[model samples]
Target: MTDTIIIGAGPYGLSLAAHLKAAGIDHQIIGEPMGAWRHYMPPGMMLRSEAFASSLQAPRSGFTVEDYCRLKGLAYSALGMALPLETFVDYGLWFQANLVGETQQADVLSLRRVDDEFQLLLTDGRALTARKVVIALGLKGFAQTPPPLQGLPARYASHSERYGNLEWASGKDIAIVGGGQSALGLSALLHELGARAHVLMREDLVVWHERPQGGRRLLARLKTPDAGLGRGWRSLFLSECPGLFHRLDPARRRLIMDHSYGASGAWWLHDRVVDKVRISHRTVVNSAAIENERVVLDVLSDGRQERVSADHVIAATGFRTDMRQHAFLSRELAEALSTQGGMPELNSHYETRVSGLYVIGPASAHSFGPVMRFVYGTKHASPTVARHLSGSLKADARQRAPARRPRAAAGASR
Candidate 1:
């Protein structure tokens, strides 16, 4: 048995493994590296955050995008600058192969508490027991399609997450929803691929920063730890000092969600994509009804109701943290877990109410602040979680006998 079993080998899982290795902790990390990133992201997309800011954290800090770029003779731009999503995936793979080697491609089907440890049953019918488990599933299985569009036929409607190729929709008129970066990026891709695309959003204007005049000078300042928007008093109070924000209680959390979760496109995508697409802002889809293989949507815009018809409707409306959406989570386990404003509640150290089970990544946003969902939070989360696991395993080691190593040939695949 291993000291810990980490699920979902994305940035969070890989970084946790690196930290555990540095601390000399005996652990096993399962799942494909950057699995969600590889499967969900569009083909030819770019990251909203800068290259330097996006990296897998480890005890040795020098091994980052900055170092990787310099070694490969690539330019190292400041934070908030965009990098192609494919390039970022390549970088993540390189980091995983070099830093963490125990990664296996396995799908965990169910997790149950057994004695003081947890038993993870794999899809292949293998069982592994670990002292603790950390769940770091990324945006997959959490993409939220709006309720209003749920009943539409599959051919006439789909969510952005379901899109893999634009060839199927070539020479067709498509209506894209939402005002976030993904919506704009998809619009740009479809337009470039010979599709007639138009974006509809409820917001009046697209709020995005224009390019900085002097290269990286202004962008770097905004992303710094002590300057600009990210370092302002309000940001600090929400992230660094969460107590102030948490004190408001349940009623306030819902109000904050409505206001804070509003979507806006990224700065890099403004002139490149937003300028090209025809946007009908301040327009809300009133009702969607099918009409002869087309989706007829009744929309309200500028104090007038309008009818629109489209061959396909794609909802880029972002995801929610609803734990019920995870079908694998057993009903018993769901009931046992605590919740905060429809999201799983977690402790400061990323531990949930259930002993020996922990959650990280986007799911842990309520506990560790909003940074938990972004790449930057991995810096603090990985080390802290590893330290906690190390201490807990050491304590349990005194009470149990040394784990017996499974016979290698006996457990080999048939």
Candidate 2:
């Protein structure tokens, strides 16, 4: 049996693996390294977070995104620099090559508790047992679709999370729902790919944030400090003092997280989207139906109802971390854990109610606040989890030793 089994090879999983290995823990890292960024996102896409905040949290400083870019001969400076999605993926590949170099590329079909360990059934027909399991599935099982569009078949409607690129929808008439980065980003990408794409959003206008400038403003720092989350005291607190957020009442923490990062397009995307993609403002999708292999959306705007027809509808509503989406979890094991507010209830160290079964990344947001949902979160989360897990594993070994001692004494008496 291995000391631990990390179920994903994304930023969180890879970072934790480096920590665990450096701490001398026996563990196995599984899944395709950087699979989500490599497959789920389209090529032209850029990360929502700044480049500095988008790297894995390695044990040392050399594995940062800036370091990778410098070594690879890419623009390695400020956040305003246009960093392609491909560049980030290439950086992840580089990070993986140096840390957690070998990975088991199979999927975890199902997971269950066997005695005191987790029995992981893999797609490769291999069964591995581990003293602990870290569910770092990231956004894999969390993509959300609006209930109104649930009835429509895949040919008519789908989520933005379901695509590697929009090339398949080439020359198609598409209607994207929502006003956030995903919606605006996809709309721009689709239009550029020769598709007639339109946006349907309930917001009054499409909003965008100004890019961080090259030089620092000394006066701006007096009012608010810059942090991994962004430039503000609140962002600083959330990124550095996540433990305090975790201690607050769950409701208040939820409120802060919900209000902080309410979706807006990047300034870079504004030039690509404006005058190129049409936006139906203050609009809501009342219902969706598949008619003649097309998506017919009943939309409401300005107290008027209208039918919008498109060859396909993309719901960029984003992901929900509700525990029910964890289908790979065995029923008995899932039922044993506490999921009071759709998200799993985790302890201070990111451990779930089920002992030895830990969760991190977006899955730990409900417990650790918004920081856990971002790549920068790994800076705190990976080292914290690795430290706690190392201690617990040693304790477990000591406990088992007492029982073995009695057996040794019995053999000597014989």
Candidate 3:
């Protein structure tokens, strides 16, 4: 049995592994590194966040974009402070190779609480037991495809998560929903790939924040517990004291969740994509029906209803937190697990109500505050969860000893 088993070797899982290894904890990290990001992200896309801000949590050996560019002899541009998605993936792989070498490239099929441990069943029919388990599965399984558009056929309708290659629909007329970053990014990508795209957003205009001036000084302030773009008491409340945020009444939490989703995209994205795409603001797609190889969308723009035809519709509607969405979780286990609002409830230490089980990343939002859903939250969660696991392992060791024959009994038997 291992001391701890981490599921999903993405940023959070890998960062936790680095921290656990640095603390001399005996653990195994499993699942594909950057699994969701690799599989779900659009090809040739760049990350919205800065490169320096994204790194594994290790004392000195963590992988960073700067290190990656230098090592690979690739020209590193400081433009926009963001790294290409491909570069970020390469850097992640490098980090996994050097810092988290014990990770297994396998999918976890199911998990069960067995006594004081977790019995993980892998797809290859291998069973592993662990004193503790951390679920770092990212936002892949939880992509929130809006329910209203469910009736449209798959050929004429798709979610932004299904966009692995925009090139597949070259020269096609596409309608994209949502005004958020993903919608804008998809619009830009589709346009670049020679597709005629129309972006329909309920908002009055495409909104985004300007990049802060200065260099590392500005970045340092942003990374602080209560400063930069993540300022305001709400941001601080979520980042610094997540437990308190978790304790807020359900109505208040819902209000907070709605308020938190208001933040928009990067300014550069507007310059690159929004300026080029045909943007229809204050517009909502009322309903969709198929009409001979085309999607007839009943759209309401500025209180006027009209029909628009497109070969495909892409809904950039964001994700929702519902434990029922996770297919790997058994129906019995899903029902047994406690929930807050619609999200899975977690303990102060990031563990679920199910003993010996823990969750992190987007799945931990209801417990660890709204920041748990963002990529940056990994910085705060990885170290804390690692410390908790380490302490638990040490305490468990003291409370339980290996089974051994008594000295008298051994001698007599021999």
Candidate 4:
């Protein structure tokens, strides 16, 4: 059996695999490299994360986004620069190739515990067993579509995460819900593609992040230090202190999750969306129906209801973590795992209640904090989990090793 198997070869999986490989752990990392960024996100979209914060974590140097840019002779800055989605995806692939090595592209058909080992069935009718499993499946199987927009036919409605290309949406009337980066950014891309995009948000006002200043003096820097999440003390703490976040009362943690990062657009997206895309504040879709083969929305804004029609409705409603949503998990394994607010309850090592089963990436956010939702969190997650797995694997090896027989007195043993 392999020492470990890491599912999902995105930033989280690739990052952790790099650490495990460096430690000489016998393991396999599977799934398409940079799958979500390459297949789910719309082309031409700019990443909300600044250039510096977008690197994949690894124990070795010369593998960060900045390093990749320098090697490619592309212009780069730690702040104030908008990282293109294509560039970030390319960086992830490069990181995988240079550090994590080959990743199995096969899909995991199912995963279940078989006695002491975890059994995984792959797409090619192949079965692999491992002592440990890490689910780093990024944001897959977690797209959250609001109730009113749910159950609509595919022709009339879909989630924003389902789109990797916007060409088909050109010249179409599109209605989007939510006020966050996804909604606003997709609106900007759709508008630029000649689509009439209207954004309906429940918030009375849209929030836009301030452009990152190039340089700040000591006092300003001290007051609001820069971190992977953003430029503020709170952001810094959340970015660097997931352990502390986990130690807080569950209710307080939930409060932070709800209010910490409300819907907002990136600084660069503000110009592209404002005065270009039509956005209605304090508006929400009450119901949706097909009228004349078009999606009709009963939208409520400022306490007044209005009828809205569109060729398609997109829910940029973001994701919700629930371990049960992963279909590959066996019924027995699913029931064996514990959850908190739909998230897998993880320990300090990112292990679940099921021994040898662990979850990382966005799914670990509830246990680790909001940082796990972003690539920068891999800096903490990869090394931390790798250290724990390394020690555990070593102890297992010692137990399996044949004990040496006591040496008999010189020449006494036959």
Candidate 5:
């Protein structure tokens, strides 16, 4: 049996695997490297995060996005530059190749606890056992569709997370539901791809992040320091002090999360979206129906009902983190998890209530803080988890080892 198995090859999984490998821990990582980014995101889409915030964590330095940029001679900046999706994916792959290599490209069909170990059934018909398992499955199987847009065929509707290319909607009328980054970004891409794209949102106004400033004066930097989340005292606290965030009462923690970050387009997206795409604010889709091979949305806006017809509707609604949604998890295991708002409760080291089971990445955001939702959060998660697992695994090994007999005193006994 392996000491541990990580079930994803995304940023978080790969980073943690790198740390575990450095710590001389016996583990296996499985999944497609940069799977979601390579398959789901649109071709020309840019990352919402700035350059410095997008690095995958490792045990050592010289593996950052900045390091990759320097090695490749690519233009680099901490902010004020939009990172292309291709560049970020390439960087992740590079990290995987150089640090976390030979990941098993297989899917876990089922996961259940057996006696004292966890058994994993793989798509390749291989069964594996491990003392510990880490679920790093990023955002997969958690797409949330608004109730109004449910039960529509793929031809009529699709979630934003399913798109790797927007060319199929060229010259078609598309109504995107939501005002967040996904909606605005998709609208921009769809419009630029020759599709008539419009945004529908429940908010009266669309919020846009102000452009980030670089090379500020020392006093200005001290006043508002740049952080992994963003620039501000609150952002600094959330970005750096996830442990503290986790200690607050659950209700207060949720309150902080609710008010901390709302839907807003990236600074670069504002110029591409505003005035370029039609946005219907204070709008909610009441129902959707397909007529004559076209999707029609019955929407409420400003207390008035209206019918908006589009060739297809795209739901930009984000993901929901329900552990039960992971079908691979057995019913018993799912029910055993103590959760808050469908998120698994995690200890300080990111372990679940079930011993030897851990979660990282966006799935841990509820317990760790909003930082856990971003790639930047790997900085804290990777080493923290590696240290805990390494120490615990070693202790377990010592306990399992056979005890030595008392040595004969000065060769008196043979």
Candidate 6:
């Protein structure tokens, strides 16, 4: 049995593994290296975050996005320059090579807490036990499509993560639903692909993110500090200190989390979206169904109801921390979890109510705050979890060891 098992090899998993290995912890990471980045995210897309914030945390400081770019002899920018999706994937692979090495590419069929250790069933028809398990599964199986489009078949509508290339929708009428970055990005991409596309947003006006500038004054920087979530005192606090959020009352925590991170298009996407793709604001999809070999959307917008017929519908509704949807956890284990709004209730050490079972990445956002959803959170989270685990393991070892006897009768006269 391994001392610890990491279920996913994304940024959080790799980061925690790096720390654990350096601390001499017995652990194994299983999953595709950079799997989500390569599979979920489409090509030609650039990260919304700045270069410095998109890196996986290492024990040392040399392995950053900027560092990767420099080593590759590519153009480097620490500020909010466009880091292509491919570049980030390659960097993640490189990080895996240098830090954690190749991960075991096996699917975890189910994870069950059997007494003290976890029984992990693997796709390769093997079962393994581990003292602890870390579910570092990033944004996989969490793409949510709205109710209206949920029932439609795959040929008609799909989530943004379902497609890697939009060329399949060429010569087709496509409708993208959402006002967020994904929606906007896909709209632009579809327009470039020579597809007829329209973006439907519930908001009247889309809030385009302002381009991040360099050489800011000290006062300005102090007021709205740079962070993964963007420039703001609240953002700065959440990014720098995630634990404080976990200490807040549940209601307050939920409120803050829900309100934070309003989504919009990248500043660079302004030109591509404007005058290129049609955007229908104040639009809400009431219902969707397959009609006449296509999907028909009954939408309400601007106090009027209208029918939108399209060859395909792309949903960019985003994800939630709903634990009930996690199919990997056994029924008994899933029922045992103490959750807050489907998010696992976690302690400061990222441990759930069940001892030795931990969760990081987006799953821990409710505990650690909005920053937990971003790759940047790994810097703080991985080290914190590693230190706690390492200390706990050593303490356990000490407890199990036979105590040494004191020198017999050193002071007694024989």
Local accuracy by lDDT, each model: 0.75, 0.87, 0.76, 0.91, 0.91, 0.86
Better of 1 and 6 by TM-score: 6
Clash-forming residue pairs, model 4: none
lDDT of 2 by residue, 19-78 (tens): 998889999999999898889899899787887788889888798889988887877765
TM-score per model over all chains: 0.87, 0.95, 0.88, 0.97, 0.97, 0.95
In candidate 1, what residue range of length 10 has the lowest lDDT sum?
224-233
Q: Please give the range of 10 consecutive residues that has the lowest summed lDDT in model 3.
A: 224-233
Assess the local accuracy of residue 156 in candidate 2 as a C-alpha lDDT between 0 and 100. 83
- Who is ahead in lDDT, 4 or 6? 4
Cα RMSD for predicted model 5: 1.4
Which residue pairs show backbone clashes in model 2? Answer: none
The digit string of per-residue lDDT tens for model 4 on 63-165 reads: 9999999999999999999999999999998898888899899999999998889999999888999999999999898999999888999988999877888
lDDT of 5: 0.91
Ranking of models by lDDT: 5, 4, 2, 6, 3, 1
Q: Which ten residues in a row have the lowest lDDT in candidate 2?
A: 402-411
Clashing residue pairs in all predictions, respectively, total 0, 0, 0, 0, 0, 0
Q: For residues 1-414, what per-residue lDDT tens digits would candidate 1 score against the true structure?
A: 878899889999999988888889888888988877787677778876556557778778666877777777876675555777777787788888778876868888887776787888887788898888898886667677767688888888888875566777778888988888778888888888888888888888877754433244555646643311243455544544443444556567556555653566667777767567878889888889889888988888777999878899999887778766665566666666647544777665677888778888877766555656677667768888988888878787766777789777976887
Indicate the residue-level lDDT of 110 in model 2. 91
lDDT string for model 3 (1-414, tens) is 999999889888998888888788989888888877787889877776555455555546525667788889987654346567787887888887888786787887887776787788888788999999888887766776666688677888888875676787799999988888898888888898999989888998777766644345655655643331254455666656666777787688778777775626776676777568898888988788888889888999989998888999998988877776666666666776647644766777887777667888888876666777666677678888888888888889988977777567555754
Residue 141 alpha-carbon offset, candidate 2, angstroms: 1.4
Ranking by TM-score: 5, 4, 6, 2, 3, 1
